[model samples]
Target: MADLNTQHMIDEIRDNIQTGDTLKTKLVLAHLPDVDMKTQNRLIYELSRGDVRFTVPILLYLMTEHVSIVDELPVIKETLLSNLLAYPELLIEFLSDTSIKDKTHLINVAGELRFEEAVPALLYLVANSQDEPEIKLIIETLGLIGDPQAINTLTDYLYAANRDLIITAIQALGQVGTQSAMHRLAERMGTDNEMDYMILSIFADVQDPVSLEKLNDTLASHYAHMRIYAKQELVRIGAKAVPALIDNLLQDDPDFVIHTLNVLGDIGDESAIMPIRKLLGKDPKSANVRFAAYEALALLPLRKGAYTLTAGLTDPEDHVCVAAAKAIDQNYSEILTAGIKNLLRPKGDEARHIAKIIVSAQVDKIFLSLAAEDFFQELSLVYLPHAHKDTKEHYTRLLVKHGFDEFANKIQGGEDVKNLVKVVAVDDSRMILNIYKATLHELGFEPVLFEFPASAIEWLQNEKPAMVLTDLNMPEITGVMMAAEIRKKYSPKELPIIMVTTQNETNDNEAAYAAGVNKVIQKPFNAKSLKAAMDEFM
Candidate 1:
């Protein structure tokens, strides 16, 4: 396929390369663009098979000697690159060569080869270079090499003045995936949320022992989004995180145990079932702890000890009782059914309270088992009208499932909320929203309840509600976070936000206050406390 001029040019270039003729090499390469593309490719094809131990240096020299020439004969650069990859040791040697000023491609090839031997050369470029893009590429190449020797240099960049550099170093260290590398990453958790979340993601993907330990430790963090991210990652980790979570149950900290229980419950591993039950046997008095434990048990199949769930009907807190009831509903047995029936049979205050729990829990089988009871019917009708819309639909489905269409229709016809004072309440829990539905209605205001805070936030942008009630520790956005967004439009006097927190730590109160919360009320709030907290702001 070689034409006369192209073959002559290739022969001249080969002759120049063999004779070590520098000026002639440059002269021959300069004529590359003057010829047709076929001629240029032919020259490259011939040079690719040439003796590159001497020939490559001449090409490198030409590359150094040129702006006009390299742009004119770009194929010379391509030919050099092809040979560099073809001979990898030569690629590493070229990477180490201080004479080759444009070693960007060389560094990239070393990384593609994952040549650990090239780290010192790459580090030398990192130390000498200040250009962000070139240094970033070099750092990334170091990460692809994943050599431990680069860890210290990468660690230094974690606190770089440039955020992009910081992000790059984090990714690089994550790719390193050594124990010390993970420890360095774990040390950066409190830097800021964006960085912390990125680092946590690395830990999650790395899944080494140190990374797992760091993730486990983050469960106890106070920041809602951070803790939520950790809980999600741990549950995603599932069985691998079980041993650590199970060990967490023995710890003295209630908040720590509660968070661990929440993750384990979502993980739904059977091995955790007995350990959790044993944990419950210690008579953990924190209602939040009991609620988390039972919530977790509801997700796991507790085949042997399911009847024990009915005992939670006697829990001092309504939420925990609901948790226990749901757990019993999921692992339903005749013995558990009889246990629940006996617990609600007396029809006294105790029976009324337990029936409310069962209704709120919304277990189809348990609700159906007691559907014919007059006491259950009376309480169900009373609460059904004001229950959250979804809860109402859920029970309506249950009622129709068992030939109680008339009763279902009755609750479905509950009072209209369109005309009442529109007070918006944002919480992720349907159970809590149901409580808001009844409590806010009783307090003489129509409750616009959202099981999703984002939906509530979107609704608030157009219409101004009388007030907004939010809860901390939601999945994507916390109550404090939502309050901050609302405060951007309406001030404390213009629009009031009442932050409902399960934990009453002073620092959390400060965060809510700083986020423009009008009042901070500790949960489990009732109509009385909620109205009192709202009274001051109103």
Candidate 2:
């Protein structure tokens, strides 16, 4: 038997639900805990058949409060999903309700039930809602439903004026993971650096050949940040990315080869070792390729990796030699006993130079001390003649400390060296070019000015500037096209490029980025903003 208050509350809920009084119905439903199980079931059954204006809230309340009426009554759960599916018009009405909390609950219910019939209504809410929270929930629900019809609408949201909406839509599309969704995401790659990692994560989930190719192309993107994201995504894909990476390695592009080697090294799989070794053996002239391969081999546990790294110590490039030495020091410590002595033996000037670098990096104190003495002796003989006054003095102190007073007496000094970073600025407007020149000079950079985009490209072919800045709307060659051409020869890490544009159009910005523009600076930018952009890439 129900208590008097509990029976009165159930009677009030029954009467309000029949009369379509939503507030009174909610008031009574709120006290459902006071009712007995039999009365709660009767109240739920009666409410399920009433107007959705009355029933939707009751269902939401029951679901939210963990009311036993929903769990103990199968008819209540079925009626909730059926009413939402049976009356899509009511969902539209609820979606249009002034209360955001109500709309969010309704969207969640529709999504939880995967009511495909309600997708149109959900999309309508997404299209019209100005509230970011409401829009985010609607977009997420549509994705949870995983309907193919939502792809185009979700893709449009990818360019929403609000960034959070764009990010939510991206995550939703990734959940959709449909072929169309993935293709749309791939098409939008490189549009924004901030969004690249999220988009690459989506692509990795796709795990198809097209996605693999896009990930591979990004490995050579003109933005170091994008390249890093691509590499991380590739490694996250793990063995899934290995075959495609290997296929790309067969290409003649040195940039592709180097990036693939790096990705393989990051993956740290032994399967890639043979292909990388073969490429290294074939491309002896490419010091970059050899360096990447040696680094990749060092990441593996193979015994041959130690010998390959040791051979890298003899390479003429200082960076390669240093990398090899560091790898030997860190990963191949056992190689130090025989390898360090073999490297130290007098072979040639380059060999001796590399040997000194290796011994200095060794962990063994005896080897390090002996190697330091030999290195200082060689340095005194090589640099004492042309050393600056301060450098000569510093070397004299070093030589004296090592008991080489004779060499210390011969020390002389020269002027200090200053290395200035070079930047190229191109704009059709002489006024903007002057601003660029003045600003760059004040920032301690040497600026090369070009009024013509063609001439800028020509100069870039001969002299490699640290970074390039160009206006978007050029006369003969647009900044984007010039950037594309430049990217053909130099990777983003090798040469970074930024575009300045008065065009606020999304298409123009997207086109510019697609053409390898690393960053975009809008018109009327000040020295502060320009310096900030330059600093980001430099």
Candidate 3:
């Protein structure tokens, strides 16, 4: 038997359900905990009769909080499903409601049901609505529906002025994941716009053959940014893109072929080996294509490719030779040892060139061998101090061990040269300082390295070095300010200052010169440039 209070609560809920007021329905729901199970069952049976007004809240409560009610009153489950399916207008009407909360709840219901019948109404709302939250949810619901009819509607919003809506539309199209949808996304990549990266990411996710072909076409795009975006997407697509990438390599376009080679290398798939080798055998005249093929072959790591890489060692282009040698160094170090032994024999220039390639790459490692005496003599013809200090020391030690005492002494004895120039060098990057250290020592100057410009400036007050090398960009004090402070005590002739910077700031360069800097060298400089700048003053 139900208690009188429970009976009264049931009567009040029934009246509220009849009134069809959301607030009254909520008030009835507030008293549900105090009601008996019989009263709860009575309330569910009364409300389960196709009442669209209580449909969302009841379903939300049943789905979230009162899930066990489905087991107790199994008819309620069937009723909720049947009512939602029978009356799609209820959800459609909720979509136009002013409350975002109510609209969001109905959108979730539409997605949960995956009701294709609701797609037309959802599309209508998305087309007519300018509210971001409503449009976002509506577009999201269409993605969950994944009906073909929604594709054009979603694609139209891809170029919306609101970036959030555009991104949401892109994601929705990715969820659609149809070939037509993918082609639509790929069509936007022709322009070098801000959306290229986002489009590339979508392509990477799609990974369909159509998307692969489109991305390959982008590799030949005149815009470098578009080509880069395509290349990165191809690499990200990885082995899935291998077949299409190989097909593109066969095209007559040299630029496309070269970019395909690089992408194939980055993918590092062995399947590209034979095709790349065929290209190398044909001996394409373009050094770019040849170098790209060499790099791709190196990454593939096939034993037969060693001959081609070795042939590249004698190529006229220094970059090609270095690329081939680095490939051998990373993948085939033992080949270098064999090449060194071949140098000992009375081989032709090919053998000597191969030996030089091996020595340039593995100079620190191979110089330790007894056969390195001839190689060391060959290396001595050029100053190879671009390596770090520890590597330079190792190479110097190897030269001394192999009986090139005079050559080794000349390199290691650079400090004893007449009036050994004391150069103060400051940079925040330890890597750059190490490069400077090796370059300065090679140029026969003692470099005083400081990671901080302030400390370098303080040291400059007392000691007068032959020159000061400082980075234009520093944390504590910029190179220009430090040079200005140094100019107060000494003239540019007395203390020549060289400023190295990575940024191409012509105005800053002018300012630095005005602040007493003798010369400014841009970053990515080599030993020759550093030596040239030092020779200008020191």
Candidate 4:
């Protein structure tokens, strides 16, 4: 078959493609010897701005060849990238090939594409090379890639003897460094050397446990510079470090308790659930703790633990009761509805009122995780409110004991919608979709809504949402195929697409990624996890 390609086939394919004959053109492409570089480049250029048919054979050919199409890369850069973002793997092939004449050109292309996978090869080049102009290009490219993998390598090179190299790596780290990378940079705070300015620059961004621990241990140091850096790192960690930051809620410092409660609420850890609930009940008047508890519940995944907060739907604190009402709506609206028939002749007006408020607010729709589905199933089964206050307390304590506090807190707070920072949710499940929609609205985002790929694409062209959230199984277009269509027709650099589903098989993930889904978030996602995935863009 390799030798069977008639020159007539190539000619006919080109002619058919020029005239918009999709079927005949694809047939011709299937028969062509894609390894012939000159012929391949000619075919690619002619159809570079055309549909995505040319992509498959070209990418396949590049993968198998393991060498860069040096002469054609410029044409690709000038023509293809301006119109369509090429596949990262194809760009990686170009960047990694030592024979490519314009290494800088490859780096530039990678930066424009935000090709995270190319970071390893680019870092290797930067670490091993002595070329100043090329090293600068490599550093800039690494910054653009922004993969966590590049952070460690770039940080190590920050101490290199070459001043320019040190500066480049430091700048690159600043651009892409995570909590851990910042911690490393902060560790070298006051060494007072040529690299001190770079380290000081990095200190402004570093915030994590390791850095905090380092700062705490060195608080007694006489240097005013060290003290300033320590105080800044503490603030940067923010209200999310409460439980870890405070020794104990009951006997902790007032400022510590205040900050810790705020942090627990901000961080949305389930481990803080019982403690927060205890505070809510004891000092039911403490706005700081009650608000923190409510936030904690709202941030958590709705589950059995949320029953405590749901019982508190009549809590004196307005926000606490409000949060409980929302949780009832977000987590148990269906169950609460089903349970009404089984309840004694008189249904409680408070529960009814809270449920009404929840139903009124829009719900978010998204794929659910296995654990989250189980939580909903349980809620569906036995949703009756126990008569005893101790019963609620006991269940809340048990929930905390069983590691269900996170879900409990989330159910209490209502469905969280923090991923609204940069996302558009799409799915077929009425309930899941409602939950996601509600969460996004709660997070203060006006996400573009779509029930299918056809609708999604229409919205995408007009709105250009920063990221797309989609489910795998659907009636119209499957998530994978939709992803391929989006990548094929729209510019990936303009909008990153994330696919969500219940499937966890490695092959499924690989296929989704190959189809051009930038990130895969499995179903039953908590708001915190979803928010973390969204935060990658920042």
Candidate 5:
């Protein structure tokens, strides 16, 4: 029986059915090897057949590691679904763990179990933090759960105080794609300002007559973005949008005329040819208007206006010349080759750069590929190290794709300082606290954890860490106070102190500096910035 307590409590729970000692059950479970595969499988069966209070820790461990419990599907449906209906605290704990990666699986489970009770927590997740990406997918799952109660919460966020969140909510609503969602989006199209692009995108999927009229009217709006959005949407709608675009082309509004012409080209409707042909003579001076007309003429399948495009190559306006060049490049490849050859021949340094841009914009597929490589190489040189870590991957990929394979190799090998660096994050949020732990694991650091100032002081007395990365608003004692204590305890020449916090607590920064913290990294930290901050300490 000694092995009973030594074995994981999940195992003990399965074994100790006779004793019924619940505290021993929990205490034993918390210490057990959290990820033991056989123990986990047996625990799933136990949870399915009977109620257990220790389900939170099991769910958390599985969620953090992204473990898919496909074998435990029946148990998940039985226990988690029942608990979710009876006790929302379990759902709250599960949803709040940001490290969870079986988000899609959990979402599917939520729907299958019909956990309508989780709607409030799901909405809270969507409305609250910027940390989780699963919220968007979860919102769609909530709708799939088919709980009508989530409608009001989703609608409220769709018209949020935060514009970015409003966009996210709108996108989620589109995924939900209910009749009420369409109606709400259609109303938003008529009333929302500077959202013409979003509205038109939603309208293409929606078959609302009112939304169509609002989009058509927006073509004549003063905003150029609106005109562009309307044209794109009309083109996406194709034949249904032809009459409205044709009607707008007849109007005298310059934005209306220009956008209508662009839509006709994108739609490639042969019916637009006669109206487009007539527009060329009306405004020969306005190059924007003329370019739009020429672009549409070139889109015609019959290619009747080939001479008009060719004749415009001699126009004095550079933009008109470029437009004509682009139009001709569509039908005739030799013209593009000859045009590029002429531009590059004996051109000065200024001409070479312009030729680079022009060639990048060319219709020849091979030269376009070369131009893209050059453009991205130039961009990498410009934004290297300054861009976010997410962008650095693309910038490095571009370098690798080009002939700069050695340069890409150097970049990949350059960030090896992570082994020499260390990070110490102190936060009350268990998820963020765990994130700090996992980041250290990934970066190959020996991390130390402390929930209170006493624990931090105890660690400082014994060990000499490379650097300290602490959160500001910790309980019992603030991180700044801990920094002062560290400064008092440690030598001035020892490791640097770097404070991390979500709250600006302006006074905290000023005070932390006063207490001799070497640096401070704010929350919502990108991995690159965090790495660079640690590199300084190293």
Candidate 6:
């Protein structure tokens, strides 16, 4: 207590804290550790009550340049963070001070505070810093700050070869959560599944109309799992997704329309019914879309015009006709039955066509809906005996199961597909598989269909059919993926694979051919196109 040098230094530090002089304060803080604990604590308390601006920088200086001072006063660093956050302008000044080299701790403070004012300094650090962890911290701080200015820099990091940087930048952009930030995220899709899925989830969280549109656009992505993930998110978005999805129908892209229809159907929003009906009325050229529409209609409740569904019974494509029959059975109408009755009265091609529709639609609801009609039942009996055994047995059992034992007994069992050359086809959509069944049979080949790629691959191990037709966008193992597996056991010369897809992009075509496909054909395929492609390998 009587030491002159130490007592004089403590007096100088006290005067510096009271005077709010930065240079004088740093000079005095340099001697702070030399004082006793009681004197240091008293000086720090005075420093805390000093000018806020002077207190922050003086504390930063002591912490950065005087490690012993910080060790002697442990609360000094936490106090520095507290003051910097409490007065963000001071945080910005401290952050912008490049002369104080180690700013990782301060950059974290800026991020944690989401200090928007600190963005410029953070950006400066981002541009100047070579340290990855520090740069990552700056990127995160900018995102947390959510200034529009940071988007360009954040997007630049998206292209970085470092996966961690790319991932961190993606997350930061997600935190920014602006329309521009989400747009930047969307642009990074298709680099890979993990990133694509990450972007999708971000869009889901943001859930703006723009994000919804971007999510809708992913339906057209060449990758199947991405498309699947997009659909799941859209479905999860529910009725809120209806307007944009309805707009998707107006676009000429039928593949996009088909996916939108699938999501809309899963959502089952009643408002979507009219838009869907309007799409159907436009007579979309894609049978896949038509099948999807009727499939959706089967799930939706019909309010007024259930009778209009009977028109599908006469659609030239068996797939469309069958889907219509399923929709009709779900919303059973005497009016629809009568409309179908009038169509069947000629009891010739139309009568036989309705019978085939009921049998192939395969639900007992549609079958029983028309079973009481003499002409229809009699006509179905004629074709039921000759229909594919699976179709026949399916109807027979469902008929018996639903208490239509009499009609079940009347369907003479089974048509032998054994005589036809077996052609393997894989598509996730049951509607598409049914189309393959009828189309392949007409070409004098038996169709063995798989609704999953895994099952198709497992079957390909033991059973190599004449040729395989697989949809390009099946879940998990895409058409290209399945083609690669099949190529392992069988050469293109040994077995031809045709990639059936709604989207005919050059990248997908190139990838499919690289995976050992014999041909890549676009969908809404007909007997003519299907046969033309099939005959090449035959």
In the range 135-214, model 6's lDDT, one tens digit per residue, is: 88788788788888888999999999889899999998988888988988888888787999999999988898779889
Model 2 pairs whose backbones collide: 388-413, 388-414, 389-413, 389-414
Of models 4 and 5, which has the larger lDDT? 5
The reply for model 1, stretches above 4 Å from the true place, is: 1-12, 57-78, 374-401, 404-418, 504-508
Ranking by lDDT: 6, 1, 2, 3, 5, 4
Model 2, 1-538: lDDT tens per residue? 2445766776787788778887787767665566677776777777877877668766766675655645666666677778887886677677666653446668887788777878988888888777888888989998898898999999998988989889888888887887788888877767786688788877777787777877888776655556556877898889888888888778776656777887898798888877877776675566566666766766766646555556667776544565466556545544554565565555567655664444233323223343345544464345344433333455466657767676566554333345668899998655456456545655767778999988988888889999999877554467877899999888888899999765444656787888888999765555577899988888
Worst 10 residues of 5 by lDDT: 357-366
The digit string of per-residue lDDT tens for model 5 on 1-538 reads 3345324555567654435655554454443344455665565567444443445434434444433453333444455556555765566566656655354455556665667767766776656645445655666566566565666666776676667656766665665556666566656654464564676676677646655666777666543335446666777788787776777776776546766776788788888877776676564555556656766665666355544454445444434444554666565554544544444444454334433323222323323333334443343333234322333455467656766676555434324233444445565444344445535544667556666666777787787777777766554556777888889877535968888754344555687888888887765443456678887757
Name the runs in model 6 displaced over 4 angstroms. Answer: 1-88, 158-166, 185-197, 220-229, 401-406, 413-423, 437-448, 458-466, 525-532, 535-538
Residue 369, candidate 3: Cα error in Å is: 8.0
- Runs of candidate 2 exceeding 4 Å displacement: 1-54, 57-103, 124-133, 204-211, 251-256, 284-286, 303-313, 322-354, 361-538
TM-score of 6: 0.80
Question: RMSD per prediction, one decimal?
Answer: 3.6, 13.3, 9.4, 22.5, 21.8, 5.3
lDDT, residue 519, candidate 3:
91
* Native-to-model Cα distance after best TM-score fit, residue 33 in candidate 3, in Å: 12
Highest TM-score: which candidate? 1
lDDT of 4 by residue, 1-538 (tens): 5665556665676677667776566555554344465665665566564544444333333323423553444554455454335455766666666655456656777788887778877887877777878888887788777787887777776676777877777677767757766665665455554455455535444544554455443333334234334344444555544444444467433323443444454455566666766765675445434544554556556556554554545554433444454444455544444343233113355444333323322212111211244434234213213112222344345456656666444333223333445467887544455546544554455556677778877766666666788876554466777888788666566677777765454655786888888888765554566677766753
- lDDT, residue 384, candidate 3: 41
Model 1 lDDT on a 0 to 1 scale: 0.81
Error of 3 at 503 (Å): 19
**Which residue pairs in model 6 clash with each other?**
none
Cα deviation at 419, candidate 2, in Å, is: 24
Ranking by TM-score: 1, 6, 3, 2, 5, 4
Error of 6 at 3 (Å): 23
